[model samples]
Target: MILGRDEANKALRAQHGQRGTQARRAAAASVIGTTIEWYDFFLYNTAAALIFPAVFFPESSSYAGAMQSFATYAVGFAARPVGAAIFGYWGDRIGRKTTLIITLLLMGIASGVIGVLPGTDSIGIVAPIMLVVLRLIQGIAVGGEWSGSVLLAMEWGDQRKRGLLASFAQMGVPMGLVLGTGGMTLLSALLPAESFTSWGWRIPFLASLVLVAVGLVIRLRILETPMFAAVVAERRTSSKPVTDAVKHHWREILLSAGLRFSEQMPFYLFTSFVLVYAVEERDLSKTFVLNAVLVAAAIELATIPLFSRLSDSIGRKRVYLSGAILVGALAFPYFAVLKDGSALAIFLIVIASMIPHAMQYGPQAALIGESFPTHLRYGGAGLGYQLASVFAGGPAPLLATWLLHSTGTPFSISAYIVFSAVVTVVCVIVLPDRSRADITDDNVYARTPGKHRTSS
Candidate 1:
C-alpha cells in the first residue's frame, strides 16, 4: 500500500530510534559481560597472592609457598594465548555473540569448580593438580572474552566515538578488580584470620556462578555485531581465522603485544605484588592493602572512560604514550611513597598508579581492535593481547618478587617498569593510529588510508 510522505518519515525515525536503543543495550551488555569475566579471572589473582600459598601448596617457607602459588597463577596466563587462538578462530568463523557465550560458560564453571575443590591437605597431589587445571580453564575463557567483548561494543557504535564506546568494555577490568578485591576484603573483615583463609576465599569463586548467569542473560539479548554480520552476509568468513591472522597480520600482532607491556606489567606490579609488598615488607595489615586496592579500583571506574573520551578527541597513540611516560616517570616515586608505610601514603600511591593505568587501558580496546581488519580482528587482536600475559602480566609479580629478593630494593623493580615503558613507547610509535579508520573496509590494510599498512 502506498503511504504518505509524512508516515514514511515517521516510520524511518522510529526505526532509527530502535537501532539506537539496541546499540546502547549492546554496549551495556558488553561491559557487564567483560566485568564478570575479569571478576572471575582477577579473583584468582587476589586469592593467589593472599590465600592460595597457605591453602593450596605444601608446607614450606612463606616465600616458597608464595612463589608456588604465583606459579599456579601464572599457569592461567600460559593458557591465555592458546585460548585466544582457539576461540578467536571460532569467533571469526562463526560469530562474536556465540563465541562469547561459550567463553562465559567456560569461565563460570571453572571458577565454581575451584570453589568446591579439595585443598592440598584433603587430596594431597590431586588437589593442586585440579586447581591448576581449573585455572587453565579460567585463563582460556578470559582469553576469548576480552576481544569479543571489545568488538561487540566497538562494532555496534559510531566509529567516531569508537574509543569511548570500546572503553566501556575496558571499564570491566577495574570493575572486576573491585568486585574481586572487595569480596575478599569484606570476607576477611567478617571472618577471623584462620577461618578466612580456610574457606572464605572459596565464597567468591562460588559466587561466580550467580554473576555468570546474569552475564549470560545480558549477552544473549544482544545482537551480533554489524561488522561480523556484514562478513557473513557477504560470505566472507575466514575458514581459518587464526592461520590467516598469523600469516598476514603477524607484524600487527607483534607490535600490539609489545604495546601492552607497559600496561600489563605495571598493573600486576601495582595490584598483586603490592599486596604482598605492603603486608610483608612494610608490615602493613592485609586489610589496609586490600582497602587501598579497593579505593584505587573505584577511582579507575571513573578515570578509564574519562581518558578514553580524551582519546576520542586527541588520538589513541598520544593518550596511550602519555600514560606510558607517566608509568616510567612514576615508577621510583611509587615505591618510595609506598615505603613510607603509612596507610594514607600507600592509598595515595595506589590511586596514582591507577590514573596512569586507566589512561592506557581505557583506549586499549580500540587501539588493538583497530589494528587489524574486521575479518581477522578477533584472532589478531586476541592473540596479540593475550600473548602479553605470558611475557608481561603473568610474570609480573613473580619478577617483582625476584627483583626484590635479589637486589633487596625496589630500584630494580623501577628499572623493570622503565624497560617495559620504553618497549611500549617504541611499539606505540610504530603502530598506526586507526581511531578514524573506516571499519566497514574489510581490507583494512590494503585499501585503507592510514598511517601504517601491512599485507592482509
Candidate 2:
C-alpha cells in the first residue's frame, strides 16, 4: 500500500482543492442566507414608516401614533446587542453555522407572525404589545445573523480576497432594501389605496416565509468554515467568548460601534424617515418616495461590489476614511436638495446620499470581521456591530423626526448625521491596516511584536 512521493503529493493537492471548493460554497451560501434575513428585516422597517402607525397605534394622535410605531421599530434595534451577546456566545463556542440556522428560523417565524397578526381594531391594546414583542425577537435574530454570515464568508476566503468575500455578505443590505421597497411599490400600484391600507401591506411580510425557506435550504448544504473547524480541532474555543471579547478587545468593540454609527444612522434617515418626510413635509406622493428609494438601492447593488474590490487594492481603511469624509461633507447638501420637493431633486439627493453610503458599506463586513480572532470572531463582531444599533440605526429615524418637528428645518437632522460621520472618521484613522496582515496564520490571538493590543 506504500505510495511514491509524487503520488502522496498528488493526494495532498487533491484534498486541498476539495477544501477550497467547499469553502467557496460555504461563503456563497452565507451571502444568500444573510440576504434573505435582511430582506425580512428591511420589509418591517418600511412597513413601520408607512403603515404600522395607522394599524397598531390608532388610539394616538396621527403624529404621536407615527412616533410610537417608530419607537417599536427602534425596539428591534435596541434588542440587537442583547441578541448578539446571547447567540454570539453559542456561535463562538458551539458553531457558527448552527447559530445562523437558528437565527434565520427565528427571524422568519417572527416576520410571518407580524404579517398575520390582527390589528388594534381586532385585538385592541394587545395589538401594539404583540407587535413590539415580535420586533424584539426579529431584532435579536438579526443581531446574530450579520456577524455569523460575515465570519462564515471571511473565514472561508483566501486572505487576499477576504475583504471582497466578506463584503458579499453585506450586499444583502441593499439587495434586501431593493426587494422589499420594490415589492411594496409594485403592490401599492396594483391595489387600490383602501385595499393597500386594509390588507396589501401584509404581502411583503408573508413573502418572507418563502425567502426564509430558500435560505435555510441553501445554508444546510454548506460545510462549516475552515477557521471555525481549526478552532474546534485545537480545543481553543473560549468558555465565554463574549467575556473574552470584552476583556481583550474592548477598544475594537468601541471603535466598531462608533464606526458603524455614521453609516447606519444616515441610512435609516435616508431610507426610512425620508419616506415619511417626503410624504408629510414636502407633500410628495408615497409612490414618488418609494420609486426614488428603489432607484437608489439599484445603484447600491452595483456600487457595493465595486467598492469592495477597490478596498482589496487600496486598503479598507483608506476607502472607509474617504467615504466617512465625503458623507460628512455631503450631509447638508443632500438635505438641501430634498428641500426643493421636486422629483428631480429627490433623485439627485438619493443618488448622492447612497453613493457615499455604498463606499463605506462595500468593505464594511471584512473590516469588522478582520478585527477579531477566529475563536471570538463571531461574538466580538456581532456584539460590536449590533450594539451600535442603539445609538445609530435604532434611534436615527426617531431622532430625525424629532429634530424636524421641533426645529421645522431639516438642517438639524443633517447635523446629527454629520456628527456620526465625524466619529467614524476618527475611528477609521485609528484602525490598523489589516490588508497586509497575515490573516491566514492560525496564531491570530498572539500580539505582533511591537504592536499594541487592539480593542475588539
TM-scores for every candidate against the unseen true structure: 0.94, 0.93
Q: Which residue ranges in model 1 land beyond 4 Å of their true spot?
A: 1-17, 447-456
Residues 1-456 of candidate 1: C-alpha lDDT, one tens digit per residue: 111234334433433465577578778888899889989988999899998888888686888888888889999998999999999988887678789999999999999999999889998989899999999999999898889988988887778999999998898998999999999999999999999988888999999999999998988787677677666555556677788888878888999999999999999989999989899988888888888889999999999999999999999999999999999999999998877646787888888899999989999999999988877789989999999999999999988888888899988999999999999999999998988878777555863223222222
The TM-score of candidate 1 is 0.94
Query: What tens digits encode model 2's per-residue C-alpha lDDT throughout 316-405?
Result: 988888888888888888888788746788877886788888888888888888888876788888988898899899999988888988
How much is 218 displaced in model 2, in angstroms? Answer: 0.6
Per-residue error for 370 in candidate 1, Å, reads 0.6
- Quickly count the clashes in candidate 2: 4
In candidate 2, list every pair of residues with a backbone clash: 249-456, 252-455, 252-456, 253-456
